[model samples]
Target chain A: MSLSVRKIVISGILGAISILLGVTRLGFIPVPTPAGHATIMHIPVILGGVLEGPVVGLITGAIFGLFSFLQPGAPFFADPLVSVLPRLFIGIVAYLIYVSTKNINNILALVLAGAFGSATNTALVLGMVTLRGYLPFEVSLSIGILHGVPELIVAAILTVILVKGIQRIRTSEDRPPVS
Target chain B: MELTRNITLGVYLPGETAIHRLDPRTKIIAATMLITLLLFIKSYEAYGFFLIFTAGIIVFAGIPLSYALCGLKPMLPVLLLMWIFQFFLYSTPDANILFSWWIFTATDAGLHMGNIITLRVLFLFTVTTILTLTTSIVNLTDGLESLLKPLRKIGLPSQELVMTMIIALRFVLILAEELDKIIKAQMARGVAFDRGSFIQKTRKLFPVFLPLFINAFKRAEELIVAMEARSYSGGKGRTKMKTLHMGRVDLGAGLIMLLFTILMIYIIISAAPQI
Candidate 1:
C-alpha cells in the first residue's frame, strides 16, 4: 500500500473508533462529577499520532471534534472552539512528546504522550470554556480536577499498553522465520 | 450491551415520498437554513410555527414521528438537566421571581429561557435527523462532496476528507459489533461487567478496549492492502457512477424553503426576544 493511503485508512479507522466510542457511550465512564461522564474519546486521536504521525492525529482529532460538536452533550461543546480547536492540538503535541523520548523508553514515551494528550484536551477545552464565560474559572477548575485527572491517568495507561501491543504485532509481522 | 441497536444516526430508511425524492443538496441546504433560523428564534410563537413546519415535513417525508424522535430518548436526561440549569440560572433585572430555594432562584425569564433553549435543541436534532432519514448515505456523500468542491481551489482535499468521513461513519456499526463481541468474550471469561461499581466497571473496560483497538488497527491495515490491491486512489480524477441532478421537485422544495425563511425572518423581527 502507498504511504498516503495507509495513513488515510489508519486515521479513518481511528476516527471511527472515536465516534463509536461516543455513540455507543462505551468511552464515557460515569463519574460523580458535574459532567457525569469522563470521556476517552481523545485517546484514539492520541493513538493516531503515536501510530501514524501528527497529520493523521490532527485529522482524527478533527473528526472527533466534529462528532462532539454535532452531538454535543453539554452547551460548552457546541462551540467549535471549545470542541474542535483543542482536539486539533492533541495529536501534534502527543506526537512531539513521543518522538522526543522514544529512543530512551518507548513505553514511558507512550504514557507521557498519552497523559499530555489528555491534559491538552482538558486544559484547552476548559480554558476556552472559561474564556468564553461559559462557566466561572473556579467552577471550571474544580470540574477539571474532578474529571480531568482521572482521564489523564486512564489515557496514560491505555496509550502505553495499546502502543506496546501494536508495536509488538508490527515488529513480529515484519520479521521472517528462520530457514 | 446492545448499544449498537440504539444508534439511529446514520441508519437510512428508504421511502418514495416527494420529500425523499428531493435533491440531497436541497435537503442539506434547507436543513441548514432551518437550523440557522432555530438559533435566532426566541418567542414561543416562533417555536410553535417551527413545530408545525417540522411536523409537516415529518409527515410529508413518510417518516413515522415516533421513529424520528427515537433518537431523542437517549438524550432526555442531558436536555432535562440543561433545562433545569437554565430555569434556575438565567434571568434579567426586570424578571419576576417564580420561586427561591437557598442559593438558586427561578424567575419568569428563566422559565422562558429554559423552554426556548430546550426547544431549540430539540428542533435542531429533529432537523438533522430528518435530513439523514430522507437522504441516503451515498446521496448525502455526493451532495456534501459537491457542496464542498468549491474549497478544492484552496488546496483542501475535500473529496478525500468526505471519503474519510464516510468510511468512519460506516465503521461506527462495525466497531460497535466488535465491542459487543469483546464484551461477550470477557463476560464468558467470568468478568461480571454489569455487577461492578462505577470505577470497577470502567477499569474492566481496559481489557475490552485494548483488544478492540488492536483488532481495529489490524483491520485498517488489511483494508489498506485491499484498497491498494484494487488500485484505488482517492478523489483525484474520480468519475461519478451516478451524477446528481436537480429535478422539478428540488425547485419546488427550494421555493418552499425560501417562503419558510421569509416567514421565520418576519416572526424573528416582530416577536419579542426572550431575556
Candidate 2:
C-alpha cells in the first residue's frame, strides 16, 4: 500500500506535535494525583485518525510511542510492551469510533472518539505495566482512574475543537470557490 | 518561555569522533540490542556493566558527560516519583519489610525493583540520546529506510513509514517554535498558563491548542501541495542521491558491540536476581 502525500505529511506534523507536547511538558496537564499529570499527547494521534484515516493515525501513534520509549517520562514506559505497543491503537480506535458514530451526531462522535481513544491508551498501557509486573493491579487501577478520567475529558474536548478547526480549513481548501 | 532550550532528542551534535563516524544502521542496531538486553537485566551487576559500556560510548563520541546527561534533568522528578512508587507499592512474598509508615510499607523486594527499573530507564534514555546525538537526521533516515527496505516484502510501506518519521523528526523543532509562540501569545492575552485550578488550567490550554492544530494543518496542506507539484510518490522507483556504505569503522564497531552483548548476556545469566 502506498501512502499519499497528504497522509505522510499530516501524520508527520501530528507526530511532531505529539513529540513537542512531550518534550516541552505541555501535553501533561498538572493533576492532583500521585502521577501528577494527565497526558494529552495522544490527542494528535486521535486527531490524525479523525481528520485523516487509520493509517495516518497509526503512523503518528508509532512515532509518539517511539518517542515515549526512547525518552520515557515514566519508568515502566521504558518497556516497549508498556509504551510502544499500546500507543498504536489510540488512533485506530479513535477512527473507528468517529466513523461509526458520526452519522448519528458529529460532535458526539468526536467526543466518543476522543474519550475511547484516551481510554485505550490508559487501559492498555496500565494493563501491560501490570501484566509485565511493573505496577500492581491495585496501583494500576487507581492511577488509571485518576489519570485516565482527566485525560479523557481533555481529549474529548480537544478532539471536538481541533477536529472542527482543522476540518474547516480542509473543507475550505478543497472547495476554494465557496470560501 | 524558552521551550526549545532543554530539548536534546532529535538534535544532532556534530562530531568527528569514531562513534560519530560509524554507520547509522550500526548505531540503530546497537541501540536496539542494548535496549533488549536492558529488559532482561534484573541484577545490579548487569546494570553496572551496562553503565560502563554506555559511558565509554559517550566519551568516545566526544559528548561532554554533563551534556549527555543534561536532557535527564526534567525527568529527575518523575524518576524519583516512580522509584518512590515502586518502593512503597511493589512487594513480593518472602520479602522483608524495609520500613512502614501509615498505610504504606516498603520492602526489600520493592527496593530492588525500584532501583533496577529506575536504572533501566536511565540507561535507556542515555542510549537513545547518544544515538540521535551522534547521527544526523539525514543519515538516520537513510539508515532506517535501508534497514526497513527488507520489510517491504510484507507490504508494510517501509519507505512511506520512514518518510513519515523523517517528517516527524524535522517538524518537531518547527512545531515547537510554533507552540512557543502560541503560548507566549496566550500569555500576553492574560492566559496564566501556570496558574488556576485543575479545570481552569486545562481550560487555558484550549486557546493554545486551537491555533496550534489549525496552523499545523495549514502547513500540512502546503507541504502536500508542494510534494504533489514535485510529482512525489511513495517509494516506488525512487533513487537515492547518495547510497549508504558500511566501511571498516562499521566492522570494528560491530565487533565491539558483539563483545559487549556477549558479556552482558553472560552477566545476566550468572547474576542472582536481586529480588
Clashes within 3 Å, all models in order: 0, 0
* TM of chain B, each: 0.92, 0.96
DockQ of model 2, rounded to 2 decimals:
0.84
Which parts of model 1 are misplaced by more than 4 Å? Answer: A1-3, A177-179, B89-97, B107-113, B269-275
Score every model by TM-score: 0.92, 0.97
Clashing pairs in 1: none
TM-score of chain B of 1: 0.92
Q: After superposition, how far is residue B255 of candidate 1 from its true place, in Å?
A: 1.3
How do the residues B103-136 of candidate 1 rate in per-residue lDDT, one tens digit apiece?
A: 8889888787778767776776788778888889
Q: Give the TM-score of candidate 2.
A: 0.97
Docking class of 2: high
Report the Cα lDDT for candidate 2: 0.91
Q: Considering summed lDDT, which 10 consecutive residues are worst modelled in model 2 chain A?
A: A170-179
